[model samples]
Target: MAFDVSVIIPVYQRQELAVSALRSVLEQKGVTFEVIVVDDGSPDPFVLPADLADNDRIRLLRQPNAGAAAARNTGVRATSADWIAFLDSDDLWLPGKLAGQLAFARDGLLKGWPHLTAVMCGFTQIDLPSGSRRHRIPVESWNAAELAAGCWFGPGSTALIPRNAFEQAGLFDETLMRLEDLDWFMRVGLLGGGVATWPELAVTVRVGGRPSVKMLDDAVGRMRAKWLEGGRVDGDTRRNLAAYLALEQASARRHAGRWLGFLGCMTRSLLLRPRLRVPLRRWWTEDPAAAPQ
Candidate 1:
């Protein structure tokens, strides 16, 4: 039997968390979906529970540590489902997540919006150790400018994308260890279909385990180069993106306790776009310890 959705999970060195994520997918209601777990050659092998080990709906594939982007691409190639949903191994879907997204798609199709390529929903960010919910990311649609500014989709787990969107936008960039979602979403935003948002919390993202400052800066730099290549972005958008990336670099430096580097980045960012001076000043004045991790 054909499934309505294929859930792709890219896991690396997190067996227990992957199991928890898989259980969450299995608990989804009102949707016929299959789970594909692509293990990116984690040193510690993922050992499935006995019940799931024998389950036909769930399949696990192992590949030599190609990172999340390649693992997700592998899962896409392995699945036959028309709709694709991605869930990070450390994150989870709440009950009715799939059902709600399916309903949203059905309504759009009924209204003659056949070009709807992606649907995203709100999510709650939970503090890892305490498991306490930190905040809810409200679901909202984004235009090209909004997307270019920053990632608004919450997390990969909150999105339900059509197979065609992947075909059109292409897979996530394997080179990026971070902000790959932003890159992919920006491409999708450029496609003119516009992402649809459901305005309901459908996923819970565990906060912590964030990448280091150097990794983030390198990744954002790569993303900036990719976007600016071939004059893909106009002048105003390019400036905005530069300022945004500069601020991201500043944040990374601040997180790493590099006060001088942080101040330099902040100055460069404000110079790129003088309108950001007020916010940059405020940010510089605030205690770095109070900043979001």
Candidate 2:
């Protein structure tokens, strides 16, 4: 039987959460869907969940520890469906996620929205200790320009996109450890696809402290490079990226007590990033103007 959707899940070291994610997928209603679990070289031996063990619809593939992007790409390749959705191993979905989103996509197809390439709705943010709390993005819709100027994937779990979009926009850039989804979203935005949102419940985004945060300068520098390489970024986008980068770097430097370095970053970011100009101006207006120059 042809499935309505294929849900791709990428897992790393979190096996328990992954099993729970599989259960959530099993609970989804009104859609015949397949689950593809690509384990990103977990160190522990994975015991396939009980519900998945006997089922042909559940496929588990093992690959060496590449990053999450590569793991997700592997999962997407094995799944057979027109519409592809993703839920991270640590994240999950509310029941009926597939049904509602699939219906929304099908209706758009017939309603002169042939260009619809991706549909993402709201999602819950699951706190590791607290269990779960629903979290949603403020925007209900996006166009190529809006998404390009700002980054919004609506969280990877909430996005359901056509298989064809990946074929055109290309797979996620594997080089980026951080902000890979943001990069992919920008590429989709550049390809001129209709991006519509349901503004309703979609998936649960699980947040936990696994990998410790990196140094601010290193993270921002990498993200800036990734965002630039992925899109047809205009002057405005460049400006935003630059400003963000500068602010991040300056703040990091300031915290480290490198006042001279902080001033340089603040000036560069504030100068290039007009969006931050007013706020930063007020911040530095009282201080020594000598630092920025």
Candidate 3:
């Protein structure tokens, strides 16, 4: 069957989580879609759940362990549909996610809006270990300038992008181990049409994993060098990106229980951009006296 959308799921080692993710995709109603599960050379090699093993709508591909970005690009190349949606092996799509995004994209195309590249929706992030949930809604507009400052498009799972956008913006940067979505979206935003976002929650992201400090540092350094010091972006964009990177490092340090490092990053973040006082205070302390004033 010619599918309306192709769902790309990149899996690493979590076989059980991959099964659940695929089930959630199959549960999506009002849309005809195909599921492509790319196994990124898991040590054990992923096998589909028995029930879905013979399902014709799903295809499983295996490749040497490339990052999620490469896996997604492979899936896109194999897709039979014009629209593509990404679902991490650990994430699940909420009901109406595919259908609603499709409708929104079609409407934008009908209206001939040049800035409509992809339709994104809000999502609920669940910290699996803590069982804490946070509902994140996308802002009304997400242009290049806004994306460079921060990643407001939620996660890769929350976007429904057309195939052409990938062709024009280029596929995800395989070199980026983290923040590949942010990097790719930045390019898409530069295409004159920024991403279209809605407030409706559409995906459930299971979080809890933390990257090593060294890994985070490396990623941040790459981002800063590319977007900030490379003379590729505007002055405001550089400042915003620098501030965002500092805050991100601060958050990572806080999560890793590195209080001193956290404080330093927070201070740098504030010094780079005083407008970040609200976030600085929130990250520092809720108490008026304790928080940065």
Error of 1 at 128 (Å): 3.1
Clashing pairs in 3: 115-193
Tens digit of per-residue lDDT, candidate 3, span 1-293: 89999999999999998999999999989999999999998999999978899999999999999888899988988998989989999999888888888988888878775643788787778888888777766654445666666675567888888888887888888887877787887787777767776557778888878876777788798887888778888866667678788888888898899999999998888887787353422211112222122
What is candidate 2's lDDT per residue for 202-238, written digit by digit as tens? 6778776533124455556677665565554667556
Clashing residue pairs in candidate 1 are none
- Kindly list the per-residue Cα lDDT of model 1 for residues 111-227, writing each as its tens digit: 766374588776777877676764444334446655665565567888888888888888989999887887887787777655677767678898776577889888887977788
lDDT of 3: 0.80
Summed backbone clashes in each candidate are: 0, 0, 1
* Alpha-carbon TM-score of each model against the true structure: 0.87, 0.78, 0.90
Which residue pairs collide, candidate 2?
Answer: none
| Model 2 lDDT, residue 101, Cα | 86
List the candidate 2 regions with Cα displacement exceeding 4 Å: 114-116, 127-134, 138-142, 210-232, 244-293
Candidate 2 structure, TM-score to reference: 0.78
Candidate 1 Cα errors over 4 Å, as ranges = 112-116, 129-132, 271-293
Q: Evaluate all candidate structures by whole-model CA lDDT and list the values in order.
A: 0.78, 0.71, 0.80
Find the candidate with the highest lDDT and give its number.
3
lDDT of candidate 1? 0.78
Task: Looking at model 3, report the run of 10 residues with the lowest lDDT sum.
Answer: 283-292
